[model samples]
Target: MPRNAAQTEIYDALGVGFGPSNLALAIALSEQPERLRTRYLERTRQFGWHRDMLIDDATMQVSFLKDLVTPRNPVSRHSFVAYLHQARRFHSFVNQKTLFPTRIEFHKYLEWAASDFEHLVRYGQTVTEIGAWQDQGAVTAWAVTATGPDGELSTTLTRNLVVATGLTPSLPAGVRTSRRIWHSSSFLSNLRDWQPPDRPRIAVIGAGQSAAEITAHLYKQHEAAEIYSVYSRYGYTQSDDSPYANQVFDPQAVDDFYYADQQTKQSLYRYHANTNYSAVDQDLIEELYRRQYSDTVSGRERLRVVNLAKISQVREIGDKVRIELSSPHLDGPLDVDLAIFATGYRPMDTDGILAPVLSHCDLGEDGRPLIGRDYRIATRPHVTAAIYLQGGTEASHGISSSLLSNTATRAGEIADSLTRTGRAATTLPVSVPQE
Candidate 1:
C-alpha cells in the first residue's frame, strides 16, 4: 500500500470494521443494482465472530433465517441455507428440525459469506483517525487513517463512512483481569492455556448466559474441582423467548421504538430486558440445577451456587486470588484459583476516532451524537460527507440495534441510504477506492 492517499481515489463509502454489521452491509452493497465503490478495514488477520466462545454445543439464540442476507433478500447466495447447501450439509441440517444452528456452524457460515468479499477488505489494519476532507471551505469527504500491518500509516478518503467497530468488553470498576482472571470474551483461549492444580477452586461471576455456560463448562471439565457460581440474584432468570414478546425484534418495532418518547423507550427496555440481558436459557438452567442436585444427593457437592452474593474485592496472592465475597449466607471471604467475569459488554465509544470531525455533527439534548432514523449522524447543512452507524443505536433504534435479529434489514436500510445519497451527489469526485 501507499503511504499517502491517492488524490483522485475517493471511495463512495468506507466501512471501519468488518464484523457481522459491516459484513451484512458489504453483501447488501454487492447485491444492489447501483454499485458504490466500498472497502472495509479490519484489525484482525482474518474474519471471526466471537471465536473464543463458540462452545461446541452452544446454539445461536437467533434463528438461521436471520443470516446475513435472508431477511432482506432471500434469494441471495450468501444465506445460511445456501452455505449449508454449498457445504453439502443441507439435507443433514434439515433432518435436525431446529431453527437455531450451532454457533460453530453459524460462524462458518459467516466465513463462507465473507469469502466472497475477500478482495474488498484490508485485514490487520486498525482505524486510528477520521478527519474532514476539505475542498476550499467545504468539508466534502472523510480522510480516514489506519495503522497498517507493520505499523505504517495508510490514509484514504471516502465520501460516505460507516462505523461498526462493535462493543468493548466491560469489567466492574476496580476489577482487573490477569492470567488467571479473564472476561468471557476470551474464555476458551484463557482456559486452554490454564494449567489447573488438583481440586482447584474456580469462581464465575455474573448471572448472564455466558456465566451460566461457563459454569456448566467448568463443571464438566473440572470434575474434581470446586466450581462456584456467584451472583446477586437468588437464582437464574429465564430468558423470555415467547412468541408474542418476540415481536420486539420485528422491523416495525424499531419504528415504534424510534418514535416513542424517551420515557416510553425506557419502559420498553425495562419490559423486554429479559429477552437479551442478564438471563439464561430455561433448558440450561434446568440442566445446571439437575447437576447441582445430583451432586448434593451423592454427598459430594462440587458445584456451589453462591446466590445473593457479590464480590467485594479481589487480590492476587501468588498463583491464587483471594476474593472478598460478601453474602447473607457466607461467613467470610472466599478464595479461588481462577475467576472469570461474564459481565458482558458496553457499546464502543467512537469519540477518539470521530474527534476531528465531531464538531460538525449535531448532538442530542443529552450531549450525545444525534443519530437520525436512517442511522445517519445529524450534521450541519454545509457538511456533505455522510456518516452512518451500524451498531450502538439502541437508544434511538431499539433493542435490535446491535443484534443479529435485525442485522440484515438494518444493513439493507443503510445500503439504500448510501445508494440514494450517492446518486444525489453524482457530481462528486470519483475514483477507485483502494490503497
Candidate 2:
C-alpha cells in the first residue's frame, strides 16, 4: 500500500467526488490555478459513473452538448468532443449526427476526463465524514475523514467542500437486496454469478427507465425466464424532454426555481420532475411497447408488466426468491422468483459529520442545508471561509441538482465564488499533508 499522507499539509479551497460534476469543477480549477486549490476524491480507485447500467445499446437521455464543460466553456480541451477526439471516436461521432452517445461510449468519455487531471484526484479513498469550524465569524474550515485502499484512515482539511457523493439506491420498504434480490445498480455483476434457470421468473419493480431497461435486458438475455414487471404507473410514461420544455433545466432555471415561493417550487417539481426522474426515454418506451406487442402476437406472453402494483413481501427462499406483489388490478397477490428494484436513490446527509461543528452552519425550516445562489452553505455569524456544495441542492437549486444538465455552469459559478471570497485568516493552519 502507498503512504496515506505526505509531510506537508494540503490546503484545498474545494474537495470533490471526481464524477462528471466534480470533473467539471476540476477542469475549471485547472484553468485558474492561482485562485483555487481543489482536490477530487474517488472511493473506487478510478472514475466511473453508472458503469453497471452501461447497457450495450442504451443512449444518454440528454444531448451531448450538455457535457462536462461545454455549456460554460465550449472551447475547453476537457470537452466531450475533445474526449472523443482523444479516444479516436470524433470522426465516427461526426459521421453520426446524433448528439446522444451510447452509454458505453459516454462511460469511456468520463474516464478520459478523469484521467486528464490525475494528479488533482485521489482514487481508492472514501470520504467518511465532514466537520466544520468557525474562525473570526465565518465558516472557515472543514475536516474530511477518509479511508484509504488498505483500510488506513486519514483526514484532510479544506476551506470548502463539495459533496457530490451521488445518490443512495432505495428498495421498496419491505424488500432488501440479497443474493436473490438485487437493485438495478448492481444488476450486471449479480447476474454474472447465477446460471440461468430452466424456467426462471424475475420480477422487476418500477415503471421508470431503469426498471423498464432491466425488464427488457432480462427478457432478452434469458430465453425461458418469465419477466414480471411491477409498477404503480398504468404504463411507462415517455419523458417530456422535447426542445421547448428542456429549457426548464437550463442554468437560469435554478435561479427562477430558487427565488420562487414554496407553492411554486412544489408546482414546478410536480410538472417537470418526470423530465429527468420518473419517466422513461421515448425510444425505450417505444421499444418496450414493440417487444410487448411482438410477444402478444407470438402467443409467448412471458414478458409481463403488472401495472399499478406494489411489492408487499420479498423473501429469499434458498436459491430462488419469492415476492408478493399487490395492486388494485390483482385479486390477491402475484408471486415471483426474484425481484429487482429500480426504484431510485436518495441523497447522503453531511449533517452528522457537521454535528460537532453544527453551531457554525445554518439550517432552514425543512432541516435541509440552507444553500445560497452560488451553492454555498449559509454559515453562522461566527464563520468566515466559503463552504461549497455539489449535492443535496434539490430543495434549494431544483431538480437539476443531481442531474448532468447544469453541471458545467454550476461548477464554474462555484469556482468563481471561491475566488471572490479571498484567503481566510486564521490563528492556526489546518491542512492535510500531500499524499
TM-score, every prediction? 0.96, 0.92
Off by over 4 Å in 1: 1-8, 429-435
Model 1 Cα lDDT, one tens digit per residue, 146-233: 9988998888788899999998899988889998889999999998899999889998999999999999988887898899888999
Q: Provide the clash count, candidate 2.
A: 10
lDDT of 2 by residue, 201-272 (tens): 888888888988888888788889888878888999988988767978899899899999989999998889
Error of 1 at 255 (Å): 0.2
Question: Which residue window of length 10 is worst by lDDT in model 1?
Answer: 425-434
Name every residue pair that clashes in candidate 2: 8-433, 10-432, 45-124, 137-382, 137-383, 138-382, 138-383, 138-384, 139-383, 139-384
Clashing pairs in 1: none
